[model samples]
Target: MSRRNPSRNGKRSTLKDEGMQGDPHAISSSFSSIAVSPRTPKAAHRMGLDDETEDVELRLLGEDERQQAANGLDVEEQSGHSTHSLSNEDKRAMVLLCVLYLIQGVPLGLALGSIPFILREHLSYSQLATFALSGYPYSLKLLWSPIVDSVFFVSIGRRKSWIIPMQIIVGTIMLYLSLNVQVLMDDPSNHVTQLTFLFTSLVFFSATQDIAVDGWALTLLSPESLSYASTCQTIGLNTGFFASFTVFLAFNSEAFATKWGVPHLTLSAYLKFWFVMSYAVSFWLLFFKKEKKEPLSDVDMSIKAVYKTIWTICKLRHVQLLVIMHLFAKVGFAANEAATSLKMVEKGFLREDLAIAVLIDFPFQITGGWLAANWSRGDYPLRPWLFAFWPRIGFAIIATLIVYWFPKPPITMGFFVFLIIHTVVSSFTSTVQFVGISAFHTRISDPLIGGTYMTLLNTFTNLGGTWPKYFVLKGVDMFTVASCKLQDGGSELVVKATECVSDHGKAACAEIGGDCITETDGYYMVSGLCMAFGVAFLVLYIMPTARKLQGLPISAWRVKMSDS
Candidate 1:
């Protein structure tokens, strides 16, 4: 294979990587770039030692330097001076880099969640298409991970190589987007050009930044600290998401022209402005360097090898259980995120109401996160119970509420209360399960195969939610299909199915939409039940260790290879 030019790419870094973060773009791009082969330099043998370049390029230490450092040879003492420069205050600069680097997630996430919501008003897609747009690309990023693993923008060593340039690229694109888009912060119709241009570009940059950020961060930490790193990663991401949703995306004034100086300040404009400001974090991130553990190269890059991981995940019993449960989790949880804004719009709820929902639920979500973190320290914190009992039981409770207990008017209060409780439970449950699943694969499986093994179950879950249902959404289609059936009592079957999907007597289905119209009560009820059942299987058959911690039954989860 032809090699990429070293001069054009820069001298390559020798440090490798451990895993990916949110998106895999950087990972996907890694292999495709030109690299300088790592080799021993002649200078190391000829000259005794050089300390000048040690601060930046010290990664490829000469044998003598390594031996000296390991042997506690004080070059500082021998030279009667320290070759190193800088003081304690200078070391504090590291915190600034972390803060700035970690800041990239906000604008990126806002742009991501914002694009679909703003653009949806402009383009007409089925409910399924809209839902798919928001969550689908996230899952597919795994397919691109290996590629991001291999490519590099510079050979200038690792930190200055692919990651630094990609961030610069992302910042540049975001700057361009901000410069061109006139009314990005306002609603779609106020846009100067077609809204699709703004949305499509925003999505691209956001996704691009995601891949790059995840790759860069993944390469910076050791495997032993991944759990802590992952927590930090999640916090950074969620914080960014919260800021974008509440502060930037939530337009509160009477009109865009009034609140923003521009006469027609659009949602696109606001988002572009945020991107311009937020992406500056990338430029700051360009300076820091931390050593990586493992790196992928051309020798191992192959379609078969990538697919082989997927096949392996499918064959394992424990892997299969994780995959199935994760899918249902998304299917249950995503429906809420997908439907929330639309729900707000329909009930004549103001954008502020949606904002309120986010605020109220966010704290609850945080509480749940803390609960999840608690599990990391103990034998039965939350993961075992989460995967064990919550999902299906939550499904059953929410189902009953929708069908019989509370499925009517007073829409805003009812919806908010339900979600606050629902999301809190889901968050805690998911956190435990997510981390638990990772621990199982990371600890029990071969290190060589760990990343692939973890992602395979993730893929199975993605495929479950990504595919659309043929019938109208569960609640709405029942009646419409019931009306269409001409067979003996086929029409009645649809009615019964519709009734089955909805709260017992409530007309929760949307008048204008197809069957799967979801109301607050109906959604809560169905999703809770589904989640509960999945949890039950996990507790009874999959994980025997689950009940010892909680009062749950020992025989509830699905059996796995590890269990046996």
Candidate 2:
């Protein structure tokens, strides 16, 4: 009693004389004294309380009570000591999950990214406009993530609720996308022709599934397990994206070949074979029942309440700024993405070559990813970080815009520049973005509510990228009328008259040594300049954001190479 109850008298209760122990929750001796009084006391009790105390401790109680008491103690001990832990099986399952997710990226990237090439070869769509479509979903996924977060058909069990079903659906959709490419090409003008909507639906579904997979792992595993799981998933997801898009391009290209008969018949055949293997994945899901989840988080419950909490978080200044930066940063990106394929086609690359080059570029990107992963590990100053963010983006925008001025498609030169630039910019930006995200993650420490916040961040990020793309496209369409009214090639005049070119110090439509301006048009140059300005904007805003993160004062104009 003294040990379990810790009486105020500072005395220990000996269990030897008492065959059965008192309940841990039992009252102290002083309380017992208050209950019984001095008149009732007897020295025979171990605590000098007499026979009554002894009687209470002794035995009409058989093995059952003793067992129950022991069980009670065990329960207490367990409740007291319980903590997050993971078995070896958990590690293995996580690895497998990462692999599946990563692999899923491969096909998805191929399907979405190769569209510009596909449009160019088969449908005669503008390469620039088609290219913009490639990165559409990722930049827009945030818009629907909340809906994805809110509902669940499989509410119980470890793997059954969301993970297994989502995988099955994604696989099915991927197969469908594969099968429908030809259907898309059959009538390019048809809204449903290429199954773009279907493809988008799959992207949304897959992103949700990804979140669930992440939540499942985050909730079930110990903190120690979190890092490895996250890394595996990240690395794998990137790898999968590479494989699906780059590695699988040959098949994608073959699907569009005239010899393949029916627009996408070849791809459909391949998808049928690929999706069949998904059946074996059931075994992985079967045992997921053993894994358990509580409510959605270490913090926050009730969907409405969580939404309200998120609303509150949205008011934070830094968060708002980050969202703005993320959004604006991508407006330029959208413009560039839309224009890149056109640039490629003009440079003389076919769909097959584009695919091949992308495949070849994957290793370099992976290297970039690795280096980024490593480089983002340490402390950095805000000024340098801010400085670092802008220059590369500036270069990219400028380089791309300048390329618009080229006389020919400039394929080989542009590809080499793009491949190298992609590697560097991707690495630098990804590393910085992840740092900001990591900071955000730290501020919001609840594991359960993480999905919602992450989704929110992703949504803002998507809005950032998507809105810009639309703006650029709209601007292009709006300006095209004014942009046109000029011929692709110019009139060729002898310009034997020195003053034949006296129109505002510029040559007129007179066919002199070529309309003098036919080699590169002013409209394309304007578009290029706009892109360059956007790049400059990215550098200016992001560089400051980086500096703010590094905690360097604004007055300090120092550039630290140690960071770079």
Candidate 3:
């Protein structure tokens, strides 16, 4: 029988020497096999083979072998950190991360959900649309994301350095803004500009902080525990949003205003609450949170390389398709969302009533995230996303119809019930879609440059959700019913020839006998058009593209850019 030996390729050849099996020096040649240390230096010296340069042949394992070894280490490490079949570190990290995400949510909820309602009484829909641009930094965070990725404090931890400082700044601003909300609003002429400045700055800090938080997620949790990380995001974000939107808006209601002996819920109170929550997260992160230190080799600290990676990712054909879908996915909803509050206000719904809708939708949002995670696992991962796509289109269409034919009077019990159900169902499906896409993005993002890749994907989706509001809000005014002056230095009414006399600073027009009101027709027209585009996008781009890409390996999605 032939003796087994190391092959020319450097792999161990198959074992064939049965006679040598009992020899202590005989090597096991199975790929799954582990070898003991080379014959001790004593044995080599005894054999007169102990040249100083002929040290023990220590070869690095192949990539697959190395990966298997790493997996083993991960299992062992996880076991050591786990108790009662759950990882303590993972649970603790999840809780801490969720709190951090909730902190992020407070500002986001205000920007995306509450502020619109607060300003609706004063600003026209077009003016409201302009406010959405303040969040434009969220969509363009990718521009600075690479810098966040490439720079870090080694001692304080890469992600935490950014997170801690940004949190302090954001928290201080929130407190300062809260203290002067009334002062800022006192000048109705400068209200929009002041708000745009303050909130835009807030969002800038929030967006930059998000870059650090996201990068931290990569280092904080193992790949197997990533779903929990997503859970932290979805739940924490929704919770924070609920607090800011429904809870804060509830405070902003006339009931609260009457109780507090103020004209409206004091913005200072809300801001103070957010300030506390923001710093709580920051404090926890600074004092308690710890990151796993990776080797310097793992850190890519080059600004140029970071941007190059981002550009390369953007230029990928598959990613381009994903970006397009992301940019268009929420258009239908964006139009409705931009107009819903205004339409409801026109229907005499109070801020508290809208809070009820958010309240109804909150549970389903959390549930949808969990369901999306479970459904998107294993062999048919894309199935859940496809399922969500159809229902989303259906909801968009249905929501459009509701707006097109919304009743003139204050909402009835039946209509309110319908709105509740619709909010729940639509929020659930939308959340499902969001989580599915986010999970997909996470899966494909290179761990080597996670912050930039994830941020890019997320920013595109956010921009998609936001940019549509500009056109929708502007277009809705083009279909306005009343011709009159806007209140509180808001944008001029889109002057339509009408019976109402122009009267600035008052809701009522002299000729109309009551407050000048815009009809819901604009809501119908804008939403309908947006829905049509949404439907076309799903059929023409999303479905076909998803089909083509569904089962492809992650590596297959990689594009070879010239610069890359």
- What C-alpha lDDT values do all the predictions have? 0.40, 0.44, 0.60
Please give, for residues 294-384, the per-residue lDDT of candidate 1 as tens digits. Answer: 3333333344554544554455433454555545544433434344344334334445444555556555554554544444332243354
Ranking by TM-score: 3, 2, 1
Best by TM-score: 3
What are the RMSDs of all candidates, in order? 13.9, 19.9, 14.4
Pairs of residues clashing in candidate 3: none
Rank the models by lDDT, top first: 3, 2, 1
Candidate 1 whole-model C-alpha lDDT, 0 to 1: 0.40
Ten consecutive residues with minimal summed lDDT in candidate 3? 23-32
Instruction: Kindly list the per-residue Cα lDDT of model 3 for residues 1-564, writing each as its tens digit.
Output: 111111211111111101011100000001101111111112211211123212211112234533543443354334422323337877777777777767777787788778877777666666777787777776788888767755777777767878888888989989989888887666533577778878888878877887767656544654345434455665666677678788888877878668668566567877887788778878887787677654433222367766766776675556777787777777756776667656666556777877878787776666666767656544345566767877776877777677557787567889989988987887677766665555465445443334455677777877777787788878876765664444445545443434231122233453433355454457677877877877787778778777655543343333221221
> Backbone clashes in each candidate structure, one number apiece?
74, 27, 0
Q: What tens digits encode model 2's per-residue C-alpha lDDT throughout 1-564?
A: 000111211111111111010100000000010000001012111221235333433431345544543443354224322344668866776677666565456445644555444443333222223334544655455454444444544344433455567667767876776666567655443433345566565555556566556555544444334434444555566566655555555555654455545343355655565466443464456654455533321222334444554664465444566667666664444555545544555445555555565566555544543444333332342222243445545555654654564444435666566655664454445344443333333222222234555556656655564555444544443333211123446742333222111131123334322342222322354356556666677667765664453432111111111100
Poorly placed runs, candidate 2 (over 4 Å):
1-87, 103-107, 122-159, 177-180, 191-194, 254-265, 277-279, 287-289, 295-300, 378-388, 398-402, 405-448, 473-541, 549-564
In TM-score terms, candidate 3 sits at: 0.76
Q: Is candidate 1 or 2 superior in TM-score? A: 2
